[model samples]
Target: MNPIDRISRRINTLIQLPENKEVIFITDLRKEYRQDLKNFIFGETLAVKDGKIVIGKNLYKRWLQKIKTKGFDYDVKFI
Candidate 1:
């Protein structure tokens, strides 16, 4: 498995978030992890519709690169 897969798997396991979920409510997250999730989503063009954050198709790829280059250091599982 690749690093990207490892990171993505960690995200899925932690959040159970799907790309087609439409929106991810900020309220659904623990306050401490909100910033980390925000940072991760900031990698791509972010959209908020009806008070939910949108997940773009390229988010995982961008986040993967960020992780590989040490751009994103937050441990999703720990956050």
Candidate 2:
């Protein structure tokens, strides 16, 4: 699938993850979608672990909001 589709699929799986692990990397977040991340407003909803950027639940929600604002859609909300 395309990067955006993959991301949407991955985000859809966040609901199945443990409450403490509902996170994703900005890089892998888009993967092949090639979406810009330089201006992403992560604020304090993320954490860096083992050199990989990990975002938290709030950030995940914000990520969805950003995507939706851009006209993206999903059958369910994972975060």
Candidate 3:
């Protein structure tokens, strides 16, 4: 799958955890690159508590910025 699709899938899986549960995970968004080398990079974990979602990395900030620039409002939170 594409990078965006992979990321989306990962996010979806992460959000499926119970409210008090912590998700310790890893991912590889890259299918293949540079002489067929698989770039299986580590991804951040996430947790949900008290109706709020917390992300361990600022990567999702870019998506938030895009939404803001487009004058759209979304309910997304990342720690």
- Tell me, by TM-score, which candidate is best: 2
Model 3, span 1-79: residue lDDT tens = 6777875664554344323344321222121211111111124345655554454334334433444465224233221
Off by over 4 Å in 1: 1-33, 40-44, 68-71, 75-79
lDDT of 1: 0.56
Q: Candidate 2: minimum summed lDDT over ten consecutive residues — where? A: 30-39
Candidate 3 error regions (>4 Å): 19-79
- For 24-75, candidate 1 gives per-residue lDDT tens digits of 5555555545666577776567777677765554564454456557744564
Question: lDDT by residue for model 2 over 1-79, one digit each (tens)?
Answer: 6778866667665433435454556555534322333245524555687788765556556655676577343333323
TM-score of each: 0.40, 0.44, 0.25
Best candidate, lDDT-wise? Answer: 1
Candidate 3 whole-model C-alpha lDDT, 0 to 1 = 0.36
Write down the worst ten-residue block by lDDT for model 3: 31-40
Clash list (residue pairs), candidate 2? none
Output the better candidate (2/3) by lDDT: 2
